[model samples]
Target: MLTCAVPTTLGPVIGAEQGHVRAFKGVPFAMARRFAKATPPLAWTEPRRCTDYGPYAPQPGQLDQPEDSCLSLNIWTPVGADGPLPVLFFIHGGAFVTGGGADYDGTFLAAHGPAVIVTINYRLGPLGFLQLHRHGLSEADNLAISDALAALDWVHANIANFGGDPDQVTLSGQSAGASMVIALATLPQARGKFTRALALSAPGRNIMSADHADHIARRVLAELEIEQDPSAIASVPLPNLFAAVERVGRRIADETEAGTVFGPVLDGSVIPREPRDVFADGTLRDVELWLGSCRDEMVMFLKSTPPAAMIRTSERNLRVAFGDAGWERLLACYRGSVRPDENPYEALLSDAFWHRPMADLARSHAEAGGAVWLSRFDHRPALEPFLSQGPTHGADNACLWAHLPDFIDRPILKRKGGPMMPADIDVAARFQTSLLRFVTSGMPDVAEAWPRFEPHRESLAIFGQPFQVVPLNEGARSRLWAELSA
Candidate 1:
């Protein structure tokens, strides 16, 4: 029973270090009301017991209890750390609609310490990113983004007593969480909150203007049959609100150019401008960045989508993205040739939606004289059939944090061949080492294999069995996409 009372500005917190790592779960970082900016947690006298995970914000298919004041965080620290450790503060990904800090178990990542890992939960879905200011609800919009900023503020103020160095915080996330890291990095308020960031498979195109946010909010109100009395939405039952959010999200996703719904809105406040503009203007000049996408970023989505539907969906998406003639030109570029089993539609979709955008962000950061390291995660798990494919979107996450709770569909370290493969151990070790290295230090120490991302010399680290740093010009699909875009 390793128990200690750590003093914070808020109060004393009691946490325990167990077998694998010491964890302090359900630590309230902030208190927030619906549609309002988050505030710091009220001071407490007694040492708050942080044994169980906190409630996740209300969203669809969440097994845990729903709560509005869901601005809590979970901290995992090394069992025996003498000095203040570097901090890895992670935000989760679920397209900004679903997922919580507790969704990721930081035990594995924390075990590689002398470093502390913190995961956070914020509001999701319409309750999160929808800007309701136009509906006469005058409150801070971008609630989810605000929640993230508040979480960082809390960490900066209180992480030192938890054996974490407030000055060496590394903000990290996957997908929407990655997007949040980018958004937060842009804000001046976040300037000194963290020293560095690592974004995994960031959804670069999800941000929308305030008008688009209002459009989604109106759609959700209509779906709930309360567009005429929008204020009633605040009092609607949680399940009803969830259903309305889903219906509106699906509708907007089908009809909108951005192709997604409910994300950080450019309200000229929280997110003053698009992330691209911020990056271009050197907003994140001080923060060291390690950002990358998986090799088959869109494969996970395509796995469930039928083959025929994949083709049709790709065409539809292209038509929506580019006009008729442009779509045809782009499609023709992809039709050149591919592997026997490779679907050109899937390849093009990956490029247009994820890969190109990720690379573009890297380019923009590099162009603005920011210190950035780019990577492509190509590590495939040792599956039974052994498909000659790259790692799917967010697959590196499972490998990176292998000590997470057992997910039914995603069994950790177990390929169909059964048992943890030696390759799995090697890959996990490399990933863990690289991640810890980057967190503790500013640059990734990938056995001296990776190079800093420079505009003229664009080399990307490839995380596979035989890890190597390859020039970005070596990838054929990326070349084709660049030519087509030009």
Candidate 2:
């Protein structure tokens, strides 16, 4: 095995979880909970162990409790900054509920062509979303967005020392993380933080609206038994404050909270307003964007929702979520074509929340005069149809970073008895090549002379059984989009 030498910046970071080495973890970039004026962290010294992954930021309750000083970053650099290298900044997805940088390893990303890969840890759920109210402690409702901005700022200043070019930064993420990247493009604080952004499986308003956002902060404050004032709420103890978040999670899905106990707050501080509106109005940074979604993006969520509840979900709600024109268009495309369903609420949720938002976010960025690159991860899975979901979440993991077995264990996935087939390994190489090309030259489809996306005219790189450049499926896209945005 190739042993990893310690870097000057990081003494050495090690993990024995099978073929894992030459990778570093848990380096603090910013002060813990620094975004909020209220919360603080446990202290640490230079060269913090970082051998093991850090604890995740707070969640509402049970299952587990992350340590207080969990705000940190993990990095993988293939080589030194001998020359200017492309940069990929990663954000994790959790619906503001679960997930952390610890869940992913950047070795694949670092080895994918030439670039520096960075994954960050941010506050989640109540620790991130609950607002500061009129009465008591641990206020500052807009913690999630604030945490993201601070992490990016840390990268912009420090990535160069690790062989990454601050100017050529590419923001990459999936699910809620993808939504956060799209949101970052529009925030004044994150302005110039990255030159390019890629979103996979984003749900719109993962960015959010002012009133709905404000309510989150107010609710957090109310939990502390304080109302009307945010300052006092900010003073509460961090542990006490996090406990309330756990309490809310028990009945979030059915409650007024919509099962989302924590997320970006439209508190007018970290995040100014709805990201869709900002992009639509051209207030965003005007950077290049690459966005796409899988065809069966929601099977994961569907399998998890109670089967009995399936009977109760209102398709009309789906229509309202998407809108009339969108519904008709979707009905035309989805109905006649594939995935015909007795009822498609689960599919609707996927498109309405994840797929359409990413597409529109790309188009809006493109409409603002910035370049755009789009795609449909139509690749079929060797696994069961439901598991892979064409371009499901983590679908791109192998593609963008191939040779999983090369530097670490489990990079090359295997079944109990079947040999690991490189079925999509070649596709992953193509994806890595295209992504490398995009990061290096800002064009994932340089060969297509792939045109930029416009509100009136859209183009996409379809990645599936037979990869090809085709006009985006507008008929299917628009209707699904309209329904969700409605």
- lDDT tens digits by residue: candidate 2, 100-147: 786666676566546777888777765665554322344454666666
Task: List the candidates' TM-scores in order.
Answer: 0.91, 0.78
- For model 1, residues 84-123, the per-residue Cα lDDT tens digits are 9999999988777777777677777787666899999998
lDDT of candidates 1 onward, in order: 0.76, 0.61
Native-referenced Cα lDDT, model 1: 0.76
Best by TM-score: 1
- Which residue window of length 10 is worst by lDDT in model 1? 405-414
RMSD of every prediction: 3.4, 5.3
